[model samples]
Target: MNKQNVTVNDLVQAATKFRDDRDWRQFHNPKDLAISLSLEASELLENFQWKDSAKSMEENEENIYEELADVLIYSLMLSDVLDVDLNEIVLNKLEKNARKYPVEKARGTEKKYTEL
Candidate 1:
C-alpha cells in the first residue's frame, strides 16, 4: 500500500490484525494500552535524553523511528478499544487549540493559552 494513501482506519486495522495474530488483544484493555503508550513515549524520549535535538536525531534516528512507531501503534490500539474516532478527535483538538492560541495574542510567544 502507498504510504501517502494510508488512513487512520488502515493503521488501526493493521495494528488489530497484528495483535489478533499474536493473541495479544486479551491484554490490550484500555488501561494497559494507555500504560503501554506512555511507556513507548518515554522510550522515544530516551533517544533525546541528555542530547541536543540535532545530535539525537543524527545518532538515534533509527531507534527514534521504531520507538515513535510503537507509541503510535499503542495510541491507535487504545483509540480502537475505546471506539473513538482518532481523526475527528484530532481535528476537534486542532480547532480548540486554534481558539486557545489565536494569532493575535499567541503569535511569537511561548506562553500558555491561559497566560496569553
Candidate 2:
C-alpha cells in the first residue's frame, strides 16, 4: 500500500492478524516484544556495519529493507499489545522534540539538545 494511504491502525491490524494466525501472541508480551524490536534494529544496523552508506545500501538493499520491516512490524505489534496509539505517541514525541530542539538552536548541527 502507498505510504500516504496506509495508517498505523492498518499496520497494527495486519501485524495482529499475522501473530494470531501463527498463535504467536502468547509470546508477545511487552517485554519480549521490546526485546525483539531491539534485536531487529540491531539487525538493520548490521547492514551498515563496517561499510559506507552508499556501499552498504548498494550491497544490502534487500536485507536492509527486510530488517527495517522486521523492526517496524515488531514495533506495531508491541504498540498493539500495549493498547497505545502509535500516531498519537509519535506526534506527541515530535512536539516534545521540537520544544527541546528548536530550529534556531538545532539548525545544521548534530549536537544533542542539551549541547545546543
Work out the TM-score per prediction: 0.95, 0.95
What does candidate 1's lDDT look like per residue over 24-109, in tens digits? 98999999999999999999999999999999999999999999999999999999999999999999999999999999999999
Q: Once all C-alphas are superposed, what RMSD does model 1 give against the true structure?
A: 1.0
Q: lDDT scores for all predictions?
A: 0.96, 0.95
lDDT of 2 at 78: 94
Q: 22-66, model 2: which lDDT tens digit per residue?
A: 999999999999999999999999999999999999999999999
The residue ranges of model 1 lying beyond 4 angstroms of the native Cα positions read none
- Candidate 2 segments exceeding 4 Å error: 1-4
